[model samples]
Target: MPVSRTERLLNLLIALLNTRYGLGRGDLREKVYHDTSGNDVAFGRMFERDKNDLRRMGFEVETLTDTGWAEDDSTTTRYRIGKDSNRLPEVQFGPEEWTVLLLASQLWERAALGTAARSAVRKLQSSGSLAAVELPAGVQPRIKPAGQAFDDLVAAMHARHPVAFTYLAGSTGREELRTIEPWGLGSRFGQWYLMGYDRARQAPRHFRLSRFTSAVTTLDKDTYTPPPGFNIREELDTLPELPLRTAVVRVRKGRLLALRRRAADGKGVPPAPAEETDDGGYDTLGLPFRDPEVLAEEIASYGPDAVAVAPGELVAAVRRRLRAAAEFSASPKPRYEFPGAGAGARSTGKGTSEDQLQRMLQLVPFLVHNQGLRIEEVASHFGISRRQLESDLHILICSGLPGGYPDDLLDIQWEDGRVYISQDLDLTRPVRFTVEEASALLTGVETLRGLPGVAGGGALEAVALKLSAAAGEEGRRAAALSGPPVTPVTPAAADMHGTVRDAIAGGRQLRLTYLSPQRDSLTVRDVDPVRLYSQDDVWYFEAYCHLVQGTRNFRLDRVQELEPNGREVSATVPAAGGSPDRLFTPNNGDTTVTVQLTRQGRGLAEDYYAERVAELPDGGMVVDIRFGNTAWLPMFVAQHGGTARILAPDELGDAARHWIADALAKYDG
Candidate 1:
């Protein structure tokens, strides 16, 4: 079997560490680098390269020459890693510092930094430096999930290899093959983007990973290099701006409150009507958006709570989508295949070998610090199988400096199921965070700080200072350049946040006086806390609701008053059913309403109400949709600007007409 480069490096490191007296070139070639035993020059070059790599990783490789007895008159040379100088200095973290480090580690929960963070945490845990502090359940911040191409692209970026993939163009909706020299990857507004030099376009281009239509294939040839001083963040900031259009929309009371906050400036538009809904619940506001399609999707997601009021073209576009959805829903699965519909790119497991090398590098240092750890304990601590640990140990034992001899390999002991590293070659130190890793952690911490009640504390500041120090000058600069901008939190929201977090941490149920936007009413309920999380700057509490008799998500902004119930949480709260995206599902009590849509509204029927649509011979469609409450249905129909009409359920039409008449009454008045 052919040995891998990782195995070869492991063997060399072990050989160098085990020898008290260094072995000569011939011994290294024959014993350690046996594959190159016949080629003296190749072995010499490989040995030199290995030594340079180790030195670059902070190891000090030393060479010594000794003259044999006068009879022989021959000089023998040897090399070994300088143990004293290469050993990492002992450093301890205070409790607060440890907590901050843990927070930083948790920031990389799902990104490319995951492996490094996990290894770092394990080392810290094994050293007993972070034993006492527990990470809060609610503070595990996650960035938007990256596409399957993420790992491959990161590897290609590191290796300076060009990559080829089929991408769906956002502008034309056409699929095209693209080859690019990937410089860097970054996240903005919870989306991963690749900043690269497009070989075909012959210009720098940024592509969203979600736009990729095929698996990323790295070319075997390493062809391009990124320009010096190129910054991903700077490139993102310089991207061309989209033209904004002001849109008049009628919003249900308390719905889309965040958007209301964002649009407070009015942008020179006329003041919005103060007219409330028929039940005195809705508010009409003018908002600005750059992309009508994206805005349409967002507005549609609001169900009946929002309606497009003006910009006839925008209303038509939304109506067309809603009609398409309705038409598609009525069809019994037969019908047309939409363009650009295909299975998503499948994630590849090609990064395992690279991850293993990283794990070994970090594992050695941890083993050195915590000797006599059971194999199971070590394996569990590193989050790997025992078999994998044993395999790594096998590789380490056979590894050493270029001179391949019995005494040149690493000295590893796994006696009675406990692991011990007798000789570490002074490589027993966790690798420092790369600039990107440090920047990512810093960005996550910054986002956390912006969350309600998270900042304005000495602990967070101390954590930031320690992170900046550990990241070094390069990391500090990168973090400062790329981190997300902070958004200020309201005082009331901050206070409420502290109370909710405290309740969650203590396993206490909370009595909350919450305003229900859908019902347009204020109600009190007892909720057993599960976790508090944020999506798009809005915080929500996922809890077991005593009123609903099931899990529910309550927006923090809508929480009027919160008080601990003084009762311990007795029942186990089940994990949230789905992510925030699918937080709401139609229940048994929702009313189903059928509607008739004209041919122009077919798009809306197919796209928005597909699950309940039925196609008609006249190129029109009928859709049956379920609503928990009919309060916003009238505005939703009015948003279509009359392309769709209620066909069945006269009560729903009556409610919608009444709401629209009231809105028109206010506007005409």
Candidate 2:
């Protein structure tokens, strides 16, 4: 009753074809091979089956005539679902639509879609039914979950129980274990959050799901109760009125037309008709969101064309931040002086390199005007190849004007095998880094240079030099390390890393001097090192230890020496499960859980196990959480000491009771 690999492969192809605008036979082969991790023969077989499967599923595939596919005696197909050609829906957006949706989800509010919705949209777009459509008003409502925490929350919500999680609060470096009842999830401001009743604090709390870690579900029934106390509908229904600060502005009717055009183009909202005002036919600009300082600054930026008429408060606030900024700017001694200004002063113009400026210009032109440049064109222009161009571009695109989203200042658009630029030119001036900035950048570059299989150490050194030049004298001060910094490689670590990595990747067995808990011992062992990772400031190799015939984690630091046995691993290994970094490892103990009831908790318990009959009252319900092993139970029970109580599972109950007794015994006087 389980899906076979071949079936999964066929399904994956079908899914891709269904959603894409259309895939030619050759295109399908390429994509399948690439996405399947270079399984060419497997891809071909799956591709062949996909055609047959499509016909069986009632899709009308159009065969392209006089195409290479026809020469090979293969049908060149384009998927069409409709039975009647006249009634056929159009194929819409292609990768462009996918990219736009991705960006819109990040930028605009609420653009999350179900997997099914994504598939449908992809299919419609790929079929060539849709073309170059941007979301209306440049905004669409979509939901983007924060991460796996949200996925777990969804599973718990379906299970209908109070969920316990360690939540990181805001920017604070602290975590708290809180139990909450389930509620609907929503996305806002590019982050997913869960709003629910907090039982411990007895308040309505909202948590950003991204910061949630180590989530666990409680089996306790009737533990959560939603009070009629908070009326969500009433809260949402109240729309606050926007307070306005009035401002006066004179516009030549033509200039007024330009202002309207700019505003409409920026916001996709048409401005109202220009009307005559008391002072020589000036128009009134009533700005919303009463930050007078901001309004004044904005008006000032309009130069003499705009003037603030009333509500002097707005004007004053704008002057405050700006005046402060101006004062701060003027107070600083000049970094460089104009050549004629002073004999001893440093050069005043911020020295940005010609190459840096050209790079900045290239990014904007390629992303916006070119819709994205051809990889070949970029390579040719830079005197490099496509791969090198892409690598450099990715690094540049990632760096931006400091601080937050939309701050990225650059975007790439890919269309017709070319890239176009989206944002304005950045890095026009040479980048200057302070002592702190230069050292930080240098440290990053140094670490990256030490990474295995990474190339172009020269490029990293160049970036570091640019940063250093930007910092001038200040960068030198920041680079001065108080204590020796922990470098990534000290020649020793590099050699070890190289040897270990090569051995693992090559599937060769190793003989290592392993330090166990008891003592250091020389042992001969064979392992299929599945993954290499660093945990808690120590490097570890997770491998299939042949001695135990199971997975084990061996500390790299504890490794006294490693020698290759030159014997290749013969048996295959199963694909590892989820990234161990994000998932919990089974601890050497049992965990105990208890049930406590609030209206919401009870609702959750029922939801979790609706099919399993349970005893309940008219208003409350009961659920149970049991652990077969009692080792971890005591600690679990102690964390939620107030709400949870050990019941039934007598062994865990006894363990919890014994733990409490031991704690009290220690303090007994």
Per-candidate Cα lDDT values, in order, are: 0.62, 0.41
Q: Please give the distance, in angstroms, between residue 368's alpha carbon in candidate 1 and its true position after superposition.
A: 1.7
Best by TM-score: 1
What is the per-residue lDDT of model 1 for residues 1-669, given as tens digits with 9 covering 90 to 100? Answer: 767777876666656666788766667666777765376567668778878766644456778677543422213677776455544334466665566666555545443555545554554454343446645555433433343366567667755789999876767756799999988777565456788899988998888765565568899576676787777777777766556667777777766765565466556554655545545466877787765555765565454566777776556455544554444333342232222223111111224444666678878877888889899988877766798899888877766656546665567899999988887765666655554455555555655565443434476767666666655643443432233332324677667667777887777889999877556677899999777665334567778899988777788878878999899775667543322222244568877777666554544442332335555666555666666666666656655544465655877666655554544443334
- Candidate 2 residues lying further than 4 Å off, grouped into runs, are 1-419, 422-439, 446-463, 470-477, 480-498, 512-525, 530-537, 544-552, 569-669
Clashes of each: 53, 76
Of candidate 1, the 10-residue stretch with the lowest lDDT total is 341-350
Score residue 50 of candidate 2 by CA lDDT. 55
